[model samples]
Each structure stands twice: as C-alpha cells, then as structure tokens.
Target: MIQIQEPKSPWEIVHMDWVTALPPGGDRSYNACLVLVDRYSKTPMFLPCHKDDTAMDTAIMIWNKVISHTGLFQNIISDRDPKFTSALWTNLHNLFGTKLSFSTAYHPQTDGLAERMIQTLEDMIRRFCAYGLEFKDSDGFTHDWCTLIPALELAYKTSIHSSTGKTPAMLEKGWNPRLPYDTLKKDLVDIHPTASSFKIMLDKARHHANRCMQDSFKYAKERWDKSHKPPDFKIGDLVLVSTLNFNNIKGPKKLKDSFAGPFMIKALHGPNAVQLELTGELMNKHQTFTVVLIKKLQLK
Candidate 1:
C-alpha cells in the first residue's frame, strides 16, 4: 500500500470536503458546511454554505476564509466532487502553485481526515440540539444550528487530539483561547511571553506533535496491514472489479453480480490504484479503481 506523506508543517497540506444536506439554518438559509482541515494540526474550519454552491463560490469562500489567514497551502486533498474537479478550481490553485490531489472513486479514506472531522462535527451538533440548546434573536426567532457552530468550533479546537496528544489550539496558535469560565477565575494571570520565547514554545509544541503523529501512523499502519493484504497487480493482467460502488446496477443488490469485468489493467497508479481498459458500455464509469476492489482473473 502507498503511504500518504505526512505534512511537515501547519497549513502545508490541507484537506477540503463538504458536509451537505442539512436542515437549513440562519438568515442566508445555509444547508451545508464547507470543511477544510489542516493535516498537521487536525484543526478544521467549518464554513456554513449552501448545498448548490458552485465551484466559483467555493473558490471565493476558500480565498476569503482560509487563504487570507494562512497565506497559501502547498497541496489540497479532496474527493472527485464537481466543485473540486472543475476547470475553474483547478486553474485557480494551479496559478498559486498549489497541487490538487483527487481521491479515487468510492474511496473516502484518501481524504480520511476531513471525513472523520465531519462525523465529529455532526455528532456534536446532534448532541447539542438534543440537549435543547436554542437561542432567540432580537426578533424573537429561535435558532439552533447557526448558534451552535461557534461553540462547537471552540470546543473542538480546545480538545486534545488523539494523534497529536495536544489541543489543536495549542499546536496551531501556541495558546488556548479563554473560555467563559476563565473570566470567572480570580487566580488566572494574564502573562504574555516575548515574541521570540513564544516562537520557541510553538516550535517545541509542533516538534512534539510531529513525533506523536509519527507514532500514531506507525501503529495504525501495523493494525491495518494485519487484515489487508496488498494485491500485486501488474499491467496487462485481467482483473474483475468489485461493483460495490456502481450506481447503474438494477434490481436487488444481493441478486446482482458482485464483480464486473475481466477488464485488462492498462496502467498502475502507485501501488493502491490502477487504470483499466473499459468497454464502451462502461465508458461513463470511472476507469481508475483502488487495488482493494480488484482481484486477478483465474482461468481453468
């Protein structure tokens, strides 16, 4: 299996994805969230947006919200969503010298950081709403989701991350933001370190975080490789593809064929994906697939 390169610095590699199809909230009627995750810190920025937002809108939003703060990222990892695949989005990043890495079809694990963060954000929202956390505006209209986002974001950033062993705020900003409880504490001292001293502390925290991340990756790879054997696929080999993600299949799923083709492997993409020589009927389908979804064809 091809190992994804770990980012060496904050905002060097970012993962972008959308959490769509939510109940409309707030004045602008936002029904979706644009999620951008920093791979190094595991810090996420959740921007409320519309589900039908186009590529241009997405680009503008990222420019204003993310790029304005972090300057520019070296790479962006995302799924093959139309907004990401569009010429506009591709060219915009290309002009800025940023590479866009698209994940293979039916594979969310390629951008797993964003996927996991979405789940966490959704769970937090559910729990908050379930607890009857609602607030009324000056006009007396009660809002649930829009009001909860800021609190959720703060809570997520302050919480210690498993892989990093430090809170995202600590890793990203070198300091934890003051919460409401901090205002009530009489013993709290407002101490601001010198710029050089603060920089040294931030560097040390990042150094520690990187080591923790490396350990986490090593442990995860060991656990995953135990159950998953990497398939040795060569060019020109005939293989059958799993139909688990195919949408064209009709009738009951259990009755349908589990595998399709005897398609010939035309090219290999790293060790985890391949390009198949597909027939005209399957022309519209994705030609590239992850190695886990393919098996060698056996003949008697």
Candidate 2:
C-alpha cells in the first residue's frame, strides 16, 4: 500500500483534508491535524492543528501556504463537512474560481486515496509522538507536532510504493533521494544486479511502469464506456452544477446536486461545457468550471 496525495497537476486538483483527534494530551480537546495534497506529484504539506478548524480557517490555512508555493488548483476534492461547506470555504473557491467536489457520503472510496494516506500518517504520528514525549527542553517538555510532520511525510514518501515500485519522491522529481541506506557500504548491502547494469534496468523499469499506467487507464475507460448510456445535456439550457461550495454541501462524488442555475448554453465543448453568460460573480466562477459539473435540469 502506498501513501498518496492526490497528485494535482504541477498544481491542480489539490486535495486538502483535516483529521480531528485529541490534542497533545487526551485532555486537550483542540488538537487536530490538517494535510494538503497535490494530486499530480503526490507531494504533501502537513499541519498539526486543532479541531476548531472551521471552513474559513481551513481556506485561510491552505491559501496562505499553497498560494505561496504552488499557486492554485482548478479543482479540490474534500469531504462535505461543516469545515468545507461553510460560506467562508465557498467564497474562497469562488474568489479563485476553483471548483470543489465532495466525496460520496457513505462510500469513502471516492476519496480513498487521501483517506488511506492520512490513516497511514496518523499511525506514524502516534509512534513518533510517543518517543518525543520523553525529551524535556530547557524548562519544559513538549511534543512538537509541527516539527515532526515534515520528516514523517518525507519518510513515508521515500519508502517504496508497492503498486508503482517507486518512491513518491522519485515519481514527483524523476530522481531518487540519496538516503543513509543508499550510502551504506556495498559489502553491507544486498544491492541487486540491476545496479550494475544501470541504463538497461532503468529503461526496463520505466517501460514497465508506463505500460502499467496506460493499461489501467485504458481498461477503466473501456469499462466506463461499455456500462452506461451517455447522459445528454444541451446548450442554452437551465442546469444544476453539482459541485461542492461553501454553503452548498450536499452530494456524492460522481453525480449529485452541487449547484442550481438557470444557466443558458453559450457554447458546447466536447459533449459538455454548456456555456452560459452571467454579468456578476457567478460568471467568473463558471468560467473556471468544466461541463462535467453541470447536469441539464430539464432532459433535452
């Protein structure tokens, strides 16, 4: 099993999640954790935080860090909890024209990638925090959650990923980090013969990974194409955009009610993107959204 952040673009489809739990002490009610994931590169930015992480706080925390580094994502997938659907959360996405999608209510597999990674992360944190409590600094004892999150994340990503047979670090950067293990003496290592024939083995591995990815995508697309009939929506029609926003939090991941609009179709791109014109705020928001978010209110 691999710990995967969504892997946005270089910066799109970023997934942000908050895990609530006890503070440094079981008595401290405020302790929670926040994690930001890039869907494309599988990179993670983590924060050790409190449960009072309301939607506004969540948006601010992300905006401050993510924008400083990776700018913005076109889409963000998160659960439809109060922290995500609060008006503050909606306004943030609207301000940037980013679309939000919520996970399936009862079925978490829609957001399984993030959930799995976070579960793995929490486990590691529990172990580290146990060890950290032993030390006293100067006058006081403390477990620095912020101090440890990065290292834990790094160790998790550098570890080999089973399905891809590569580390998340390597996948993101196209290179492996030189670790203490790598620096160990050759005599102390069981270095494979693949190391001796570097170029040849590297080529083989890349080819294999690429082929596997291609095959997976192909199979999924084929299955999706075969099972369902095409849903038809037309231009110049009223539609509901089923996406997650600050105040509008009710829907599943795949198909749900995200928005209600008397959207008139302006242009058709592919089998979707039924464009509409609006004078004020909503127009800019729609400009960033794709046709996949909308469904024809009246079938025609």
Candidate 3:
C-alpha cells in the first residue's frame, strides 16, 4: 500500500466523489450530492446535484461551489468514475495545473477520505431529506436537498476531527468560527488581537495541527502494516477479485460467488495494486484490483 501524503496547506489536495441518487427534490430537482474533502483539514463540502447532470454540469458545480472559494487546487484524488474521466474534466483540471490521481480500480480505500465523507453525507441526507424530520414549509415538507446541505456541511466543518485534533473550520481559519450559541453569550471577551499576536496564534495553530497530523499518520501506518501480509503472486498469475460490489451489475448477488475472476495478472500497477487482463463476462470492466481484493488461483 502506498503512503498517503499530508497536505501542507488547506485545499492543497482535495478528494472528490459522488453520492447516490436519492428521491428527487422539488423545484431544484437535486437528487444527488457531489462530495469534496480537503486532505489537510478533513473538511467536507456537499453540493446538491441532479442525477441527470452532464460532465459540463458537474464542472459548473465544481467551479461555483469549490473553485470560486478556494481558487484552484494543487491536486484532486478520486476514483475512476466516468464523470471524472471525461474529456471536459481532464481539460479543465489541466488548464488549472491541477493533478488528477485515480485510485486503483475496486480499491475505494485509496480515496477513503472522500468516501467517508460521502457516507456521512448520505446518512445525513437520509435522516433529514428522506424522513422530512428537519422542517416544514406552508406547502408541507421542504423536500429540498439543496437547502439541507449547507447546515450539514457546517456541522461537519465545526466538529473536531480526530486526526488533526481541531475542527476543520478552526484549521482553515486558525480559530473556531462564531456559532449561534455564541450570539447569546453575555460579556464575551474580544477576540480581536493585535496583528502580530494574531499572526503568532495562527502560526501556533498550524504547527500544532501539523504535529497532530504527523502522529496520526504514524499510528495509522503502523496499524496497517501489522495486519497486512504481502502476497507472493507475480506476473501472469491467475487471481479472483472479491465481488464486494458486483451487485451493481445485473445479477443475483447473494447467489453468486463472493469472488469473481481467475483472470490473468497483466502487470503490477503499484506495490499493492495489480492490473488484470479480464476476459468473457468481466471484460470491459475495471481492470485494476488492490492486492487485498485479489486472491491467487491455485491448481486443484
């Protein structure tokens, strides 16, 4: 497995992914969410989108919601989703000098940062938008996914992240953002400090955040190294890929084998990922599998 690098600054390396299409919302017609996570701050931005949106539409949302605020990013990590692989997406990022890295096919863990955020957003949307538990308008339920996203994003940003030991908002701003609870506080001390002092505090916060991130990385690497045993399979080995999400295809997933393959290993992509030469039914599908998901086929 490759070591994930820590970003030196917020928004330097952003991970992007899409959530599932839910019951369509009214007027806006938003049925899906575009999720982005900053590698450094672990801040997530959830933008409501329509399931029918084209590549251009996705680009426009990225421009408006992300690029407009943070400017251009240094890198974007994502899975090999068609929306991300399209020519429009490629040229756009190329224009901005933003490097695009795709995770090994069938290995979502490579983009786990954004995947975790997507899971959280999906859960929150189900809770509020699906259940209609949050608020109601004169016309009954709001049924507006777009309206619900901002609050959810804010909640995630303000909550403390374990890896950084600071809330995303705090890491980004060098101080916790004032919330509704603070508005009610009486005799609140002035936080406006002299320019030099403010600079010093910001520096201190960044230093502390960096230290926390380094420790988190070290612990995570150690834990991962402990249980992971590298496979001895080499080139031209036949292997079966774990059929974890094979249900996405048309099939009785439960009745089917939990693993599918015996495909020939064409090449090694990286230390922990392999390129497979698939044939028959699995052809035209994703060809790369992480080592964890691939099992060597031995003669009976």
Q: Highest lDDT: which candidate?
A: 1
Candidates sorted by TM-score, best first: 3, 1, 2
**Model 1 C-alpha lDDT per residue in residues 19-59, reported as the tens digit of each score:** 77667777887878877778888787778889899999988
Candidate scoring better on lDDT of 1 and 3: 1
Give the per-residue lDDT of model 2 (tens digit) for 14-95.
6666655534642343366676666666666666667776666766777776677777787777655677777877887798
Per-residue alpha-carbon lDDT of candidate 3 for residues 85-123, written as tens digits (9 for 90 to 100): 899889988887778888777554463444444444455
* Structural similarity to truth (TM-score) of each candidate: 0.68, 0.51, 0.69
Model 3: how far is 235 from its true place, Å? 7.3
Candidate 2 shows a clash count of: 15
Query: Going through the candidates in order, what is the number of backbone clashes in each?
Result: 0, 15, 0
TM-score of 3: 0.69
TM-score, candidate 1, is 0.68
Give the range where candidate 3 is weakest over 10 consecutive residues by summed lDDT: 201-210
Model 1 is weakest, by summed lDDT over 10 consecutive residues, at 200-209
